[model samples]
Target: MTIAVLAVQGAFIEHEKKLEHLGADCIELRRAEDLNQHYDGIVLPGGESTVQGKLMKELGMFDIIKSQIKNSMPVLATCAGMILLADKLEAESKVHLQTIPMTVKRNAYGRQLGSFHTNATIKGIGEVPMTFIRAPYVSQVSDEVEILSVVEERIVAVRYQKQIALAFHPELDNDLRIHEMFLSLCK
Candidate 1:
């Protein structure tokens, strides 16, 4: 299966490598026409949400990706990607795709110095390594969103339908379970 990793901004390379290691053909979606290709799933990597959101709009990729997600295409969104999917963004006024029914705080962990690494339990996925770099945490989730993982009493990972939103960077770790889990959803 071919997976489209958003290369507009952030750590798309890590995600692309992870998927390739998992035997999935990975494609870097650098432009709107890339979205026209037949792909099994999409991966929104960790990066600057504000910049990514802006570029997607100016480049005309935002609406197409949003429509695909709404169609139930599996999506694995991490860090800034999670912010992109959140319906309500705290501390920030802009709402990007507004796909997931949740509220997130931008830089909830403070500045870059607040970045950390931890082991957390994700529902059904077991314990895994999580790396957070200027990450945002989900403060509120609607009834439809399932709480997947939490660290220090704060929600870190959640799943809404086929879209999995994570506040941490799973691509930074050696554990392939999270990527495998997302690929399974694509099937």
Candidate 2:
């Protein structure tokens, strides 16, 4: 399977490495034209949501990706990537892709010091290491959204249609189940 990683900003390289390790061909999407390539899925890595959103808009990739997701393109979104897919933000009025019908609270875990690591059970994939760095949690999700995993009573992962969104960075962990699960969606 082939996947596109949004490399304009954020921790994209790590996701690329992880997907490649899973035997998937990865294309780093650095420009709008990169979206023209044939890819089965896309990965939105952890990073500053505001910067990533602005850069995507500036590069004219935002709408293209949004349309793709709307048409059922498989996507694996982590950390700020979750924020980008959320339809609403608890504190901010601006919504990015608005593909997932959920509300996310940005940096709900406080500052960088609030970063942490733990194990949680995903719906399909059992317990796996989760690394959170200034992560955002899902405060609310529509009836169509499926909650995948919860930590400390907070919703951190959800699946909607062909999209899998997470508040933690699975790429930061050694576990490959999550990445493998994402690749499965490509098939």
TM per prediction: 0.98, 0.99
On lDDT, the candidate that comes out on top is 2
Q: List the residue pairs that clash in candidate 2.
A: none
**Candidate 1: C-alpha lDDT:** 0.95
List model 2 lDDT by residue over 90-178, tens digit each.
97899899999999999999999999999989999999999999999999999999999999999999999999999999999899999
Tens digits of per-residue lDDT for model 1, 8-88: 989999998989999999888888998889999999999999999999998889999999999999999999999999999
Give the whole-model CA lDDT for all candidates, comma-separated: 0.95, 0.96
In model 1, what lDDT does residue 83 have? 96
Candidate 1 residue pairs that clash = none
Candidate 2's TM-score: 0.99
